[model samples]
Target: MFRPLVAAAAVAASFVVPPAAAAPTPATPDQSASAQQVRSAVTELAEGLSLEEKVGQLFVTYLHGQAADEVHPGNQRDFGVGTPAEVIAKYRPGGVVYFNNPSYDNIDTPQQIARLSNGLQRASRVPLAVATDQETGLVTRIGAPATQFPGNMALGAGRSTRDAERAAAITASELRAMGINQNFAPDADVNSNPANPVIGVRSYSSDPALAAEFTAAQVRGYQQRWLSRDSVSATAKHFPGHGDTDEDSHTTLPVVDRTVEQWRAVDAPPFEAAIRAGIDSVMTAHIRLPRIDPSGEPATLSKPAIDLLRNDLGYDGVVITDSLAMAGVRKMHPDAEIPVLALKAGVDQLLMPVDLGLAIDSVVAAVRSGELTEKRIDQSVLRVLRMKFLRGTLGHPLVDESRVDASVGAPQNLAAAQAITDRTITVVRNESLPLKTTLKTTSALVTGWGETTTRTLAGLLGGTALPTGGTPTEAQIAEAVRAAASADLVVVLTNALSKQPTQQALLTRLLAVGKPVVAVAVQNPYDVAHTAAPNWLATYSYGAGSMAALAKVITGELKPSGRLPVAVPGPTPYPIGHGVTW
Candidate 1:
């Protein structure tokens, strides 16, 4: 059952004053209690916890289920528990991470998620830091009924810090309404490598300065108190930068070969800006930087690497590992040993460990054997507790589930998303633009990589929708060609054209149909470099808002104001900040 309002207030009041004459100021939405007060409260709380409970406070794990009380086979196998409530009762983890993936079905509807959050919190002795990767673009874990933005690169292309801040603010409000107090967002990695498989389009820009500015703005937006007493803790991720790697950390450890100086110049600026902006947390990257830490450990396990954030950047907040279950961190140590090493290396919270039971037991064993001191455990616990206090999680862990629906995808939030996406649509080439003018007496055929995106675009333009797969088959190309022949215009949507040769072939065939072809790169603007289509536009996302923005640009309802955040190097090379305006 949800904690009543009066009970919550009483619980909040218990932590208000220390057992001293001079009472410390209570934490507000924007500021935490005085350091002394928080430390005193944390110390008193720490003194009462058992070794296992203290170690438990250092972890934030993900369980498999939508509701906290629902039985899940995966959770049963992983935790010897069938429900999130049982897992929390048994493990007492410091926090919980939410995912919308098939394996971890933690998010469904807004009210369902709110109820789930409340259930999880009720099962916990301490307030659980409920978090999700709501980074707004490609990494958004929660989808529709929640306003979707065109992503970080779209915001980068729009080149407005105000838009970046507003986007984050909207996301924070929605996330808090659903009872999620933490968000891993505003990806600070500068997409310096066009070939970077993981961080492309997720990054703000290739320019360090621009990435820094936007990162700070997003941090401010996310941490700012949206309601009088509620705000989401914003985390700047992949610290030291994952922007230069070609490999995904989920599969293997990638190497960032920048020198200490080069890393400081290219990769460190955004993190610096994030720290300066008072970001609540910094997530370590799994990538190894040989120059900074020659010990051959990923930053998540590298003392020198983490020191850059601690000593150099002076970030004294929570430090979380990306995911111990990922191959990048797993390759170095055994499943049980990874958490111990991450803690020894200075990460406060172990996120998504491979085996929560084994990880906690290992830490407990390490403490017992004197390998890791209890003081070390308390330090991390205090940091986590301090953050929870500052973010108002301790006081108001349970949200009013009834109010969730009214805020999740509010109309004003949707409009903010559309307005941001509209500003991010970039027209790279304009040979047959303002399709409203050119196709006044003719019809258009929308054929593209994504079936839904193509159909949506077709509906918006009142054109025929010929949806094609990401890799269009020969028969699909033929069908698109036949469809193009009957239409006066062809709006070809391409996603990563360089990777999908079959889709590129479809674009070639549609262009040859002798109807004017307008190519819209829905996912990556770099798709423009691979094609010679006389007309090109880039929306950086295939989201609904992006589709609307694309249709409006084609119809001349909105002018393209977005610039290329990353360089496109091919026949017609486009530098950073290149965009065509009418």
Candidate 2:
């Protein structure tokens, strides 16, 4: 059983920024003085911290538990502590990142998450920045009870900055209600390569200018103060671009061989836009660009690569590294030296190191041994503290858990999510669309990448549902085809058909069934290039909002208005803005 607790009583009223001027704009003279005062206050606080505590302020770590007091053996082995509260007390990290991995189980419900957040804060002396990867498409960590907006690519297809802003604002509000102050979101990557495994739909568009526009809009949205509380900090991620790589950085290091000129044209615009919008943090990519840094190191550990962000982009905000536990940052260096190299490379915050204890000790030792100067340590610490102060984390680190349910996944937020995704249904081929007109007495079969997705869409349409796994077994494919034989319309959902041969086989067999077939690309729109389904549509996501919007479009209750954010390349190529309107 879970209990919702009142907000902690330690919140400082002086740190709250007036709601009217919460968005980061060019400071007025008075605002500048206020900012200076914040810097001075943060400096004074930093001066009082012990060396170990100051070093601890540079890391954002994670542990496996839902409740603060829950004991886990992994936590005991890793931190010599049995609970999250104990880890926070010992290390006093600057922040903690939440994940929804069932194995880790750090998040469960709105009430539970708020309670956990308050508990963690109570354990730390200074306030902690509770963060999560609530990127809100295929990458969303929190489900259902939170509004699920169609992701960046969907916004790209709709080409609406207002939608992007509204989506991000709603997401930020829910995050604050859950006691989270930072969101690693609004991925600024321009998805130039359709084959990019990690960033396909996460990116807003392939066009640099469009990606930049949406990135700036979302940054403004996330940082806009809501309900008189400080806005959540938004991070524009995978800086220096993770858009062209076909590999997943989590598994291994990816090399992007673009020349500096090409990188500027294709990758740098969105991050530049993010900086201009006053983004609170910029996350480094685990990608190697030999042309940018001849030393052959991934950007997360390369001074030259980071200098591009610091010097070239003129961004002075916090620079956070993508997870240190990733193989991309770990394959070339020993665990103990990874954080040291990252700090040396000019990163301000180390996120999710493989071993938290080792990372903290290494940085502390480096500072004491003159490998890293205390001034350098103070440089990062001041930035972290300043961010905490400006973002209202220092003022209101706790949320009234009892009121969390009222804000998170609110009815208005869900409606906005549905409205946004409603405009994102892109019709590529419509030979058999507007099912209402095509079939007077209709029987339909819904089969796709996710079992829940197929069943949910089927239930909406009152159709027979045959759910297929990611790599559909021959038996699943045969069952789908057999189920489709008696249906008036066959709706098959495809996710990256270019990679899933089994799904491609299933789609091909369904197409041959001779009934009107509607193929929907639920994950990546590029899946359309691999199939010859005469009727095709793309929802860009399989979230409940997207599925609801998709069903309305199929039933002629809504029109298809979304354009393709990226080109579909194959024997027959679709241009970047291709979409058919009925």
Candidate 3:
């Protein structure tokens, strides 16, 4: 159903590394980069690339599922998109865009990603860009037992740029070790609007200056980690002002009505700072900005935004397009016409077009027919080659065992997650009504919460999926309510509402339930005011630490001391930064 489009957008896009020929590494090599020799080996593998293959390096197609997931019958894998092996042997896209679905074979370990990078390159016999949304906190793609740090908003509020820089460095180190060469992170889109559909916690801050500072620090942090080889390149994304738009681009084109003065002041600084900081890649957003291009082609197909990057900002790196299949482009042109238009509009590479081969052919045919210049194609290939060279994946596949494995998400990683959980597990307010010491209720009402799910290994916690402010549908809530009615203390594990309708409605509904409602806020401090559920606990970011912190509070491992650091508006039902202690 339409849920697929919404579900896909539900994947919160998010972020990070170090050093030199003398070599650079992070404090911990939880995920270590490949050695220079391996990088050299990969570079050597690039020596025999053909003309078509060289051209193929300019497009990054989004395959259907994960690398480990086997492609099934009836699922088309054309357009430079498919399993890592098939996509390599066939479409040979220059870069690959990952959709975080391990069930389809894509996974949560650096080793798994490294194996995918190796397998894909081995089949294609050419180096490629391995990228994903690895931003920690809210928009993280890689999760589970791994260290999922606080989101940009939290980092924006943390121990200064130095702390953020270290976080970014750690992130890049993790990605590089996993064979992920490029990170589509450091969301420069400032969280200027609270109701903005997509880029909320994903943005570094509501303030432009802070967002710019954190974005730059994070990118620089990741860049500092992997010198040149076995490093990860940073991509600052959603050019212009995707942060303030209320429309969700995945399903609809959200237009930013800000005047030129508004944009020049509010939306332009973060990106300007990122470019100035020497970010390697800049991605176009799908938002329609009439102030810039009134023709309604969206930034991805408009020359103005791309020109801003080149002529105005003096950015000479690659210009990456957001996925072309988004309704943003479909609203203006034929699906096949997306890649062609983007090329003509000054974009370097078409990202994740619906049909890989068709998209490639469209670009190729445009070049051959002189509609798109061959020189343009070469320029993009050169950029792709440069990145491949930098990462040392150019020569051949290097599947080093030490650089990967499930242990990447083992103990410490989960412990880090738990630590973050404790720090962010804020108690906005406490009535001293429900005591944390004693088992207050006979039947505990546990609701499904968190960015993903709340499934415990032991199955001891039987909670209904209370997908608050996140992605729970009506059907999901109906089930949650039924489960809550049978419990004594209802724990509503609610996700933050960043413009997801169904989830928000479910949370609003959960408040009236006649039980001791413990609302678990996952993403933001704002959710405290959004929920009417009297008793609430905030796990600022959901990860191992958050989960552990919540468990500790429930089991008296630690007492609730965190109060709401931010204020909430009244008449909003649930007041801002609101929290309750047992």
Candidate 4:
């Protein structure tokens, strides 16, 4: 699909500025001194560790509170009480990833999760790098008062670097407060393909430059370390690029066939800028790039791709692989062989290997048999230790378990999220806002996918609610149109009209009515391209904060200031940056 862009990308690459000449960050005096000291500490720690400890430092395994009723393989260890201590004693992994399963309500509160992290630290000789995928919006692992900020697309729509920084800073504060030291976020992918199932709202924008700016802001924000707390390492993930592919890597390996120049034009800038901004980690993607590496290896186990990150981008920080459990990589190799392949490919840490004990043994065997040298293992171990020292995990590794309740979702954090949401509700089309003045009444009909969401929007507008299930039947659309006939105005809420045929039908039905119809996109902004509604709004999120912010925008309490982060596909009346003000 992207093959034709090679020539244009080649021309663009010549004009793109090298990262060496990029704008320098305004680092404080204390930060500069601490940076050198942290590096020295990491080197010293690596030299003192034994061979067994060095082997352990290369693996970052997972520990989820498995559901009591659910039965699965490797369920022997519950990760409760004595079991985790024994596992850690034998395997001695470098880090542990926390996962919240939807099927089970395990570690439901912040305090419980914090206590779990503290227990894992106690069982390890070196401090564990506790991590989570707290990307906000649908991907946020931790729930509740922990401000569910709008996703990356909303931040791109707002187009405020400061807002991007604020969102990351607040997220980092909460994670560190709960004893989690790493955040796998601020996705750098340039979402060029609208059909991308996995990287849709996760990416900041389709424009490489815009994504680069926000990615850099997020990296700076996450590494800032407020309130004198330990910093949470910010990761710029799915390296090289995951945006051009339509396939999701979770179920199958997506192939991106763009030339190296195409990648540099659309994907490399963000990673280069992130490296310059001092990103603490880079995560490899599972997708295969045929043009970049002819051997047909996924980026996780390809030395050329990893070398591009190390040499071309000049990123010296820790390089971590995306979870090995994903079918993209799992289908390619056995559990025991994955750790060795990742290390030989220049990855510093192996994340969520299928079998932790088997992975450790494979790396140990590789070193002894000359397949992998002991010195090569030491290099990666040094980088992992440096990350822990830089994040303060080695020094002040423990959190005050009592403070977890007060600090996890502080009221101020929610306020910041709301403020960002308020600034990011994009008005793509409008006949003038505060529909009360245009229609001469507050009475309106609000219909959407869920009853709760429809009711929330209706209540905010002081109107009646009509729930239109995602796939609305003809009878349901008829009922909604009848309801719209009596109202002063009609507002239809949609997530993605391209994906939802019923929602598109409902929009067409509402527009058939003589009354003015306004369409509000709660999730994907692409719906606006399908409707000719006089008023259109895009929030890029269905999160609570974004919904409340949308309500304020509809009632004229807050102005819609956000621009479109990406092109609204199909036939849109507006350009990429189009938005209404006042």
Please report the candidate that would top TM-score against the real structure.
2
lDDT-wise, the better of 2 and 3 is 2
Instruction: Give the runs in model 4 whose Cα sits over 4 Å from its true position.
Output: 1-36, 66-82, 103-107, 225-230, 437-441
Candidate 3 lDDT, 1-582, residue by residue in tens: 223212211221110122332322111122334333323332333344554665677788665544533564313524233344666667777887666764233664566666666666566545568788888887788775455677776565442677677667667766766777788888889766667768766876666777788888877876653234435778888887698787799999888877767877887888888766667678899988887788887989888867776767666667888878788767888777888788777777778777777777777778778887766766566555545544444432354657466445556555544454454456654443344444533456555555344643002333433433357777878877777777665666656553455656666666566656666666665666654556656665665545666656755556654544334333453433344544
Q: Rate the local accuracy (lDDT) of all candidates.
A: 0.85, 0.86, 0.63, 0.78
Ranking by TM-score: 2, 1, 4, 3
Please identify which of the two predictions, 1 or 3, would achieve the higher lDDT against the true structure: 1
Q: Once model 2 is optimally superposed onto the true structure by TM-score, how far is the C-alpha of residue 152 displaced, in angstroms? A: 1.2
* 18-106 per-residue lDDT for model 4 (tens digits): 34423322121124543444445566667667777899988887754532233333334433223554566668889877778842233
Per-prediction TM-score, please? 0.94, 0.95, 0.76, 0.89
Tens-place lDDT per residue, model 1, 115-200, is: 99999999998788999999987888999898899899999999999999999988988898898999988799988988889988
Using lDDT as the measure, the top candidate is: 2
Q: Which digits, one per residue and each the tens of the lDDT, describe model 2 over residues 1-582?
A: 101111211223454455454555321214655565566566667776889988999999987799899999878988899999999999989999999996578999999999999999888888898999999998999987988888999999999999999999899999989899999998999999888989999999999999999999999889875223536888999989999998999999999998889988999999999887878888999999998898888999999989888888877778999999899998789999999999999999999998998999999999888999999999888878767766777666789988999999999998898898899989988886687553347898999788889998988888888889789999999998888889988999888787889999999999999988989999989888877889888889988888898888898888899999888887557899999988
Tally clashing residue pairs in candidate 1.
0
lDDT of 1 at 502: 92
The candidate with the higher TM-score, 2 or 4, is 2
